[model samples]
Target chain A: MASSNTEPVIIVEGLTARYGEVTILQDVSFEVYRGERFMILGGSGCGKSTLLKHMIGLIKPHAGRVVIDGVDITRADEETLHRVRSRIGVLFQADALFGSMSLAENVSLPLAEYTDLPPELIREIVRMKLGLVNLAGYDNHMPSELSGGMRKRAGLARAMALDPTFLFYDEPWAGLDPVTAAELDILIRSLNEGIGTTMVFVTQELASIFSLGQRVIMLHKDVKGIIARGTPQELRETSSDPRVNHFFNRQAD
Target chain B: MPEMNHRGYRLHVEGAPGAQAAVRLEGRLALEDLKALMADLQAVPVKMKPREIAVDVAGVEYLDSAGAMALIEMENLSRSLGIPFELLGVSEKDHGLLCLIDREALQRPPLRPESERPAIVVRLGEVARRQYRDVLEIMTFVGELVAALAYCLVHPRSIRWEEVKFYMKRAGADGLPIVALISLLLGLIMAFMSSLQLKQFGANLYVANLVTIAMVRELGPIMTAILVAGRSGSAFAAEIGTMVVNDEVNALVTMGFDPIRFLAVPKVLAAMVVVPILTVYADFFAILGGLIVGITGLDLTAFTYIQQTKSSIRVFDFATSLVKAVVFAMLISGIGCQRGFQVRGGAEGVGMSTTSAVVSAIFLIIVADSAFAIMLHYVRH
Candidate 1:
């Protein structure tokens, strides 16, 4: 057991999120420890993305709170939220890169906006971040000029531009070939192991969840909350819930 | 141990006679206290000038990326000044952060020099090349539209009558109120201004001739076409541009349907048919405005004003305006559809295409009107 003195970096308590009259997620609770790769797993329409958004403070929860480093993000003011947001980075599902900017400009945006660094130093940092993602010399290429996998890597580079403490990825391997997906998985693991930055990934891909996650929380649309939580080995070997077993074993209902 | 406290942060330096100097930092080291922390760190090398510096961050309660960057900068400065530097006693959280900084720093590539902007002649050549490509694309679009029209003529049943009616109502009936309002006001202003000049010489009766001939020959078609270009042309570009962005045009192509036939033809045919009818309305409204001016401002009876207007406008003048209306409609719809098909990227692309459609349509309308004016002058001679 971890020591009680070491506080969890993120504590999401009884979070209930809704869009209009439709409740997407309810009573969802989880904790992400420092230096851990946490995975949110569910099938389509299970509100994984919504949960991620609530955690990021992009969407206000219908109820409950997300406390990051002992500060409740749901109730945090703009100043507090800005500080919290600057410490974390989110990679959207669509990559959501600024369509008008080249890869270098996209990667440089957070640094430029947050710091008072000179342009020369900012450019050097941009090249370094892009290099980390294996896109070293493609600075002049626009987002439209990049392939799907390259754009995702660029988005990842942009996310890490400020050396954020917590990184959130929404479907990092959603639309990539097997080779590129494995490459990204390797990159994610290396980044986590090398830097120890806390990572939270939302994905339904069994391979990715097994490969990258240190701990996993499974959500269900029918339950409208987390249905199961455990490590991949534990879930695979000891879980008795039919849905959990079926999901882990890849058995169709 | 000697410690310096500033802005809620502390830095303690410990040095031995033959051992490396050690610096301990504590408290919140975030953006707010970054400048003070940097200033304090800068004084270390100047004051003690240690041959080797080791920073201990075990007591740091909070450290953001900005703090890490400042620390890295200090490390780099110490190294550059021939002082070896190292970080010691970093906690798990701080170690993670410092590791990120160290990794990024090690991987930091040399910055490339900014490329100079190309020479003016090179820029001009690029623009000319783009314009030439645009002209070719436009010509190809015109040819495809003509072929689609020919196909429709051959097989009348294949024509999308429903789409034609939809676009007709959207382009013509939906735009009627604004077009009528602007045309009425334009005619009123023209007649009022011309009457001010004609009344000076007892030639106020000629105001009726001036308004009628001008409205029928040039102003009516041009004004109606400009209004339609602003309204319907922009709409066409935006609607089809969005469709193109969403890959609906590609879907149509994959389904063995020409987008020109399915999309562009209905808009062009509708514009060609409705603009001429709108031009006739504009001409009538302008003549009525002249009649009003002649009666109220010139002390002439309404019948005399109507008779003067009727005699001034010939069949040739009316036909020429209708012909101009057709040409203007073709330009408006053609350019609008062409711009729509050229849409790339996303929502911004749609907006650019819409604006380009309106501007290009108006420009082509004026150019075509001038060409018609030159031809008419020679024909009259």
Candidate 2:
């Protein structure tokens, strides 16, 4: 639906990553369309997180370019990269909140840095962001004082502080229980619909893939590239690749 | 289209004076000029004190969360001023953002204010209790270390020689240059200063006696101990403290490894073995330094100086210096491991432990040296 008229929001062209003599990912290419939910699923050590990092320009590829919002972040100048980065947000797996700052301070940091808004407006925006994540009235809690699920939600609030057009999540459900993770999944879905923001999720959670993924790419360790690319339903119902089938059906092998 | 600034904001008021007024806002209502926007909204109710104010935002191009919140704040201000107010031309996207903010949540008070600082007497008492607990913890750690060392003594094959070797290279070999440099300079300064007085008495040869006696007994061992404390002692604390912070130490314990024996013993053994050897090297470099001063500054032959140094130092002096070196090594390594084990919290805790390791090691080294000096004086007499 987002083809032709509007350009793709992200373009990862001919990406290759190597660690010493070992090739982790080779000649991987993909495009994320505007306002679509894209999922990257792979087995452990299959380079899911590595690919996500490359897509976000956190780790430079041995050979490739990642263009976000038409700016090639891989080769962009600092000012251009910063401008490109301002339109996107990333939620790391470890919930990298500043241990020294309170939850409100963590959420307000981007607003204070990037905007010329008054302190009162920034404060209200922080409240709205936190409230969006169901973390209302917890502005004074330190990151150390919060539970794991709470910290993850707080991290999400901080990521959404600038209302970025693109959101990238790295294993958002890795450490949560089923109920909490399901709640988080629902929250992500609501935010996606409400904000109409493009999202790229790197996860192995089949439930999340089925529930939220509009498009999916499966990375394979042996092949060192994407093995299957399609919608989650198509991959689950029609894919002939044994690896893709094994992953979707939760097979042991 | 109305005129707008570079930030894309404009405010227009219509209706004659003292008549019902309509306020029109146009262009991008975004975070960039929110401060000025807020000032404009505040001026709306004051300037006209209008009986009714209608805010129209249909011409607004963009509305961020801050922009939405600013409009809400304006509505609240108008309500408090008892002026009838209404918002017009709310776009679908803007209305969604406005609905997302929970107004009651914003009005809720913070959970609690920051706690006030305690009284001086209470803070002093807390510090005293903390120091007391620190002493008790040190004693317990010393006991555990002794037990682990005794176990290793009984089963020498059980000692981790690999770790011992690794630490030896770090604490001993890597520390040689600084130890050599500082002791050499110390010996040169001592000899030169003592030579001035000795030259007055025309006893330049005795400068060798003074330098040899001082270097072998006090300066050589103490200077080497201080350097080792600064180099390896802080390193030991920081390394182990970071492990504690990362839960690596806890993992080792959960896997049935005695953290003291597994982590501390090798570093302690390495320091004890290398520090005494380093002190001997320190003594040699210091004497060489005294020989340089004697030849260049004191007009004494190397052979004469060497002969005086040899006669001045007995086997008793070497034994005493080695004893001091070994004891200082134990203190440095022991306090370092103890402080590291006591670490809590995060990276700040590791930093605090590292600094405490160096300062405490130097202090204890000087204290022990004083005790040795007094005890050795009576024994020599």
Candidate 3:
């Protein structure tokens, strides 16, 4: 209940997500506290990504509301949504960096568009952000020129450009070697600690869940809603739900 | 004393000229206040001309990274001017934000040079080398296409007739309306212009002669081919280019199918079969257009116009036009598929290949037409 002591930055109340006739998440509700690393875990074809999309306001839900920092993004106007979006960043599954832009240009894009800060200050911030992600000197490299791991790191740097209050990651560990994935895990942890940004991640990586997630919510396709909610350690050892217990045990094996 | 206030965020510098300066920052020092922050900070050294400056952030209610960078930038400016600068009363949280970035790293120049261009001679050499490689690539692709076509001929059942029918509908039947429209307009315009001249010589019936000959021998096949080049050629390139980008072409190869025979052969075969038929349709529509002008504008009977057109064009002329249509069809579809197979990058690459396909197809069609004119003349002689 230490998390309950803190104010909730994101409130998802009775959210229902549907694609055509199929319901992916129904009447799902959860709260993510300030400065918490929350992981959304589930089996394949579950509503993990659908829920993340609803949370980020990329896709509207069939029913319910997602309020981020006092603004209900699902119901917000364009101006309000734009304002709320400026305070957040998302890292996509494929590290969706613009192929046409250099790393420096990509990192500086948000600053240039949103702020009236001078170019030199923006450039300096770009360098510092890139430095934080261990890509200090790769400012001019194109997205196509970098390896998959480097591109992911570059994507993280761009995501951190505005020092967003909330950061969302969609399967950041996918398509990486174990070493690179572990390195990425450390980077995520450091960034969360350094900036104190609330993070929402959609992933099925058990190692990342155990290592990084402070609180976890598992979704099941059959349930069409949150199946389990607890600390990773608690979910591993003390979960009453057989499906949740089986998920933790099967992955560990 | 100089001060800047933007939305209650304020920067105040108190000092006499060429003397010690104390700068105080107050209110929310965040992103929205940064422009005023930098403007005020930049003005401090200019107006006060301080030999030493101290920035006090204790009055600041909140500070973010952009605000932190403003302070860092101020320190750099003072240092460059040989003026002593100090940051005072920064909270530990703000200090951590400030410490996250190393000033030295920001000062380091980027590894890449900005827009490096070679000497003119070297650029010319590169362009020439690229052209040579392009020609060689086209030759290799043509060789592969010939071999694939030969294989298909030996095994007629190997051709994917379903795709051929689909492409025929796409490239031929779908294109018929536009082809008919443009040919009709072409015939109407030619007959109108030529009737004015021939009427002066009391040869008004010769308008049919002129329109029928031009439509069948030259304008019919060439215009149809050019329109198809613009329509189906770009479509073929973009379709195959996107397939290459998505690695579907590679998948076909990996699954033990020749990509050219699997993808291009159907399109080429469909175009080769249908484009000539489209040319014949174009010729007929053009003649109908000429007949309209003959009966309406020139006061000539339909029977007279039809007989004059029949007398003007020989079977030899129709044969040449069909030959030209077949050759132009090959060039258009062939160039499109070749450009598609040459795609290397992503969406932009596909776009470039599509545009190149249309331009190269049209250019080759005109060149082949000119060569045909000369060869046919020598053969007739």
Pick the winner on lDDT between candidates 2 and 3. 3
**1 or 3: which has the higher DockQ?**
3
Those runs of model 3 whose alpha carbons end farther than 4 Å from true positions after fitting are: A1-5, A251-253, B1-4, B12-24, B42-61, B77-92
**Model 1 lDDT per residue over A8-75, tens place:** 89999999999999999988888999878899998889999999999999999999999998889999
For candidate 3, the clash count comes to 0
Looking at candidate 1, what is the lDDT of residue B233? 96
Off by over 4 Å in 1: A1-36, A54-84, A190-198, A223-226, A229-246, A251-253, B1-9, B12-21, B28-50, B61-82, B91-113, B202-206, B239-248, B284-309, B344-351
List per-prediction Cα lDDT, in the order shown: 0.85, 0.87, 0.89
User: Model 3 over residues B1-381: C-alpha lDDT tens digits?
Assistant: 656544657777788778889998888777776677777787787656889999999998777666777788889988888899999998876776677666776677777754579999999999999999999999999899989999999999999999999999999999999999999998899999998899999999999989998899889999999999999999999999999988999999999999999999999999999999999999999999999999999999999999999999999999999999999999999999999999986778898999999999999999999999899889778
Ranking, DockQ, top scorer first: 2, 3, 1
List clashing residue pairs in candidate 2.
none
Can you tell me the CAPRI class of model 3? acceptable
Candidate 3 Cα deviation (angstroms), residue B292: 3.1
> Per-prediction count of colliding residue pairs?
0, 0, 0
TM-score of chain B of 3: 0.94
| Cα lDDT tens digits for candidate 2, B1-381 | 232456568888775445677889888776667787877777777776878889999988777666776787777788888888888999876777777666766666556554469999999999999999989999999999999999999999989999999999999999999888888887899889999898999999998888889889998889999999999999999999999988999999999999999999999999999999999999998888889999999888999999999999999999999999999999999999999998887776888999999999999999999999999999899
**Ten-residue region with minimum lDDT total, candidate 2 chain B:** B1-10
Ranking by lDDT: 3, 2, 1
Output the better candidate (1/2) by lDDT: 2
